[model samples]
Target: MDPIKKIAYNCRQATYLIEKQQISSITLKEKIELKIHLMGCSICKLFQQQSMLINKMASKHFADQHKHISLDTQFKEDLQQKINDRLHKN
Candidate 1:
């Protein structure tokens, strides 16, 4: 296989890299491969976006670990509704 082809990641690998990237630094080769893969793969790109958003939300929500906080009731209800809808759909 060509070197470039060998470096190209499948969707599963790309997603793993996407998640790994959030928690730690990937090697330069992996970064390059992931960047190239994301450029060509819209699905993986979307996954990366969603993962980043989730991480940002979680970080923000948990930033004050010692402080008391509560999830908004409206947000909880909305999330529950969405989950119920998806479960019924399947």
Candidate 2:
């Protein structure tokens, strides 16, 4: 495979790992490749910035709300069942 394409792919994987909080699982070489790609790819850089912003906002919102929220066992079970049904349907 072409080196540039490989680097782009690694950048994408790095972005996903970052989102999943799994960046520590990536190899040093992959981290370097992603940094190099982000340096030159404006679109990917924007994506990374937006993703980080979203995660920060979501974490803050959840932290504020979780203290006041309580879900019953039945509700949790029903929600999980619905999610599983939808996934299986798809």
Candidate 3:
């Protein structure tokens, strides 16, 4: 099998586990394999780490938002505009 395909498969699975929080937290063979791949691939490592960080931060942010004002639509719009601008630049 191609290395790119292998990495893509692992990335999809790793993201699911990261976002959904695997059913078995104690069993992390797949997670370990992902880390092993990350150790060698800087790009994959950055993507994995960034995704995990985003997931964690979003979870906590939503959990905390229950205390006060919620839904920052302007922030999201600004973010989208910035992203679009950057994408168009390329």
Q: Highest lDDT, which number? A: 1
Report the lDDT tens digits of candidate 1 across residue range 17-90.
88888888999988999888887888888888898999888887788674777899999999999999999999
Report every candidate's CA lDDT. 0.85, 0.75, 0.67
> In model 3, which regions exceed 4 Å deviation?
2-10, 17-23, 26-32, 64-66, 69-90
lDDT of 1: 0.85
Q: For residues 1-90, could you state the per-residue lDDT of candidate 2 as single tens digits?
A: 898777765666757756654334676776677777777778778888898888789889888977977899999999999999999999
In angstroms, the error of model 3 at 57 is 1.9
Best by TM-score: 1
- TM-scores, in order shown? 0.57, 0.54, 0.40
lDDT of 3 by residue, 1-90 (tens): 886457545766555555454333624765665665566666666776787778689889988977787669999899999999999999
| Model 2 spans with C-alpha error above 4 angstroms | 9-11, 20-25, 66-90
Where does the lowest 10-residue lDDT sum fall in candidate 2? 17-26
